[model samples]
Target chain A: MVEFGGWDMPVQYPAGILAEVKAVRKATGVFDVSHMGRLYLSGPKATDFLDWVLTGSASTLRVGRARYCMICNEKGGVIDDTIFYRLSEDRYLLIPNAGNRSAVVAWFQRWIDEKFSPGCTMEDVTVTTGLIAFQGPGTLETIDQVADTPLSGMRPFSWTESAIQGATVFVGRTGYTGEDGFELLVQGNDVVKVWTALTDSGSVPCGLGARDVLRLEAGLPLHGHEIDEKTTPIEAGLDRFVRFDKDYVGAAVLKDQQENGVQRRLVGFTLPGRSAPRAGYNLLHQGETIGAVTSGSYSPTLDTSIGMGYVLERYVESDTVLDLDLRGRIVQVNVTALPFYTRPRRT
Target chain B: MSPDDRRYTKEHEWVMIEDAAAKSAVAGITDFAQDQLGDIVFFELPKVGDSLTHLGKMGEVESVKAVSDLFSPIDGVVTEINEKLLDHPELVNQDPFGEGWLIKATMTDISQLDGLMSASDYDAFTAGPQ
Candidate 1:
């Protein structure tokens, strides 16, 4: 276990990260994500406050659906990437990174006090609740064996409440694993029960180590690595999450960046070997440094070294050959598309 | 249990004399080292003919979670690195005591092994008493 965001969390189980990652990819895996922030927002003007505070259009988000977006400062730098679920016409539940939980709350509260106070209310439900991710291809079948409500009809990015082990469970059909999965939230006391039921049904209990490797292989963005308070989402190739039609905290700058290309573009690369590139490794092209790796690791499933980093727009094309300075040894790298691995789709 | 046929170091490495006349010795990380590193992914081993100082930084042991320095328990000139680790570093985790041997080197001074701990001493040292 390691100290993460003031929480002592497991980096990996005794089965190890490689086994855990393979299990999540081929079968089913569960992650205890209770350290993430779970904030409940409500009131008549909650949507308005959220729309102004978020880059996505809250007005268009239908009830029971969740939207992945980033909370950015006025300068277009991302404060935190988050997923918010609209539970009702005027209520929403937002999940933020654990390390940035307090910052997100303070930022949202600042906006509420300035514009929508008395009309908007935010409640931190993180401590009182537990969140775990049930992910992979076999998740649906595995969950059906234990969960009372079938998630077959639940659309991707939608949420529904179900009963499991005589406890109220909030299930969201959204995950960061680049695979079909659900995020299970329950009362703090019932977390162990719900987790046990899932694991008892063949779900592998995973830890943060596997989670990082899985996300990197999927080409997903991570806070402080791909996106940060100083790096705008535009530079990170996250334009799709930004609704240009709506105005928000960083609307002008993000829109301006959309029309005019940003300075850097984040891309994925792969080397065919066990020798992995690590964060802070220099990206070299023609003997000149152009960018630096943000996160990198050996993909156990893909049998290759994978990494993500930002480079000049000129080198962002797919299949563009580049050199990755692997600890002073310059090695060739093929600029692959984001997500070095994609799960096989099943009907 | 760590094999008592070899000498153990405080850095969690084991050295076994292979040829006394040739001054050849084989070294690898201990079971404790591999366990602490979790899953082995890549090993940056020194090439043949490279000199390794006693308890000095030799290369690196990259695991699934983090990168840690690989320390040499014996001072010597590298004779060979386990070629298998170049392709399958997991061998370190699978058989840390046998096929996972990292380096084969000609020892600078055989007396260096005397100051090192034995298998039982290492077990007790790692057990606590830090």
Candidate 2:
């Protein structure tokens, strides 16, 4: 176990990270992600307030659906990458990274007080809720054994409120892993029952270690690693989430970046051999340091070392060769596409 | 289990004298070491015929979380390496004593083995201070 976001969480189970990762990629795995913050926002002006604050246009999001978005500071730097779920006409659920919960809550409260007064209210629901992700190709089959409604036909990013053994559960067809999966939001007290039911039905109990590997393989940027308080969404290659059609907190800066290209871009690269290029390693071109790695690991699926890092904008294209300084040894790496792994489509 | 015939290093490497007349020995990381490393993904081995000093850096072994330096327990010249680890690094995790053996070396001086701890002493060392 390790301390993550002030919570003692398992890094891996007895099966270990490698086995857990393979299980998720091939069959099914479950993750206890209750540490993520759950914030509830509701008011007469909820949609308008979300439009002003979030990068994605929440005004158009219908109930029972979720959209991946980011909250940026006035300078356009990302405060936190989040998911906004429209639970009701006036209420929305904002899930943020665990480490940024307090900060995100404070940021929302400040915005609510400053702009949308009288009607807006924000509540921190993290302590009362338990979040679990049932992921991989076999997720639907495993969840079907316990879910009251069959989840096989649920579209991605859609959610439904249902019951599990008399306890109310919010099930969403959303996941951080690249695999098809479902995320369950249940009352804190009912977490164990829900977890046991799925695990007994064939979902492998995984830990945060496999979660990191899976997300990395999927090319999903992590909070502190890919997007942070100092990085703008444009530089992070997340401009699509920044809806220019609507005005937002950092709309001007993002719009300017869109017009004039960003100086640095997040790019993916793969090593020629087994030597893993870890975070803080330097990316060099012609003996000059261009940028540094953000997240890297030995990919169990690819059977090679792969990583994502911010490099000079010119070096962000496919087939661009750069030297990764692992410790002191420089190894050649090829700049590849963002997602190193993609799940096979079920036709 | 740690073998009685092998001498152990505090760093978790084990050396067993293979030919006393030629001052030759075989070395590998212990089972405890592999267990601590979780999954072995890569091994960086020193080339054969390389000279190493007692307790000197030899190579490195990388797992999912970290890359740890392997150390030589005695002054020796490398005779052979476990080339199989180049392709199947998990051998260290699966069989640390047998197929996972890292290197074979001809020691410059056999007396350096006296500095290493016995298997029982190593067990106590790993168990932590009482």
**Best candidate, TM-score:** 1
**Could you give candidate 1's per-residue lDDT for residues B1-130 as a string of tens digits?**
8999999988999999999888899999999999888899988899999999988999999998888888999988999999999888889999999999999999998878999999999999899954
Worst 10 residues of 1 chain B by lDDT: B121-130
How big is the positional error of residue A76 in model 2, measured in Å on the Cα after superposition? Answer: 0.8
Per-candidate DockQ values are: 0.83, 0.70
In lDDT terms, which candidate is top?
1
Against the reference, the lDDT scores of all candidates come to 0.92, 0.91
lDDT digits (tens) for residues A1-347 of candidate 2: 78999899998888888999999999999999999999989999888899998999888999989999899998899999999899998999989999999999889889899999877899888998899999999987767768887878888999998777777889889999899999999999999999988888877899988898899999999999999989999999998889989888989999999999999999999986677888889999999999999999999999889999999999999999999998889889999998999999988
The TM-score values for the models, in the order shown, are 0.97, 0.96
Over the stretch A1-347, how does candidate 1's per-residue lDDT look in tens digits?
A: 89888798999988899999998999899999999999999999999999999988889999999999999999999999999999999999999999999999999999999999899999999999999999998898877767787875689999999988898999999997887899999999999999999988888999999999999999899998999999998999888899899888999999999998888899999998777888899999999999999999999988888999989999999999999998778899989988788889885
Cα deviation of B101, candidate 1, in Å: 1.1
For candidate 1, the chain B TM-score comes to 0.96
Clashes of 1: 0
Docking class of 2: medium
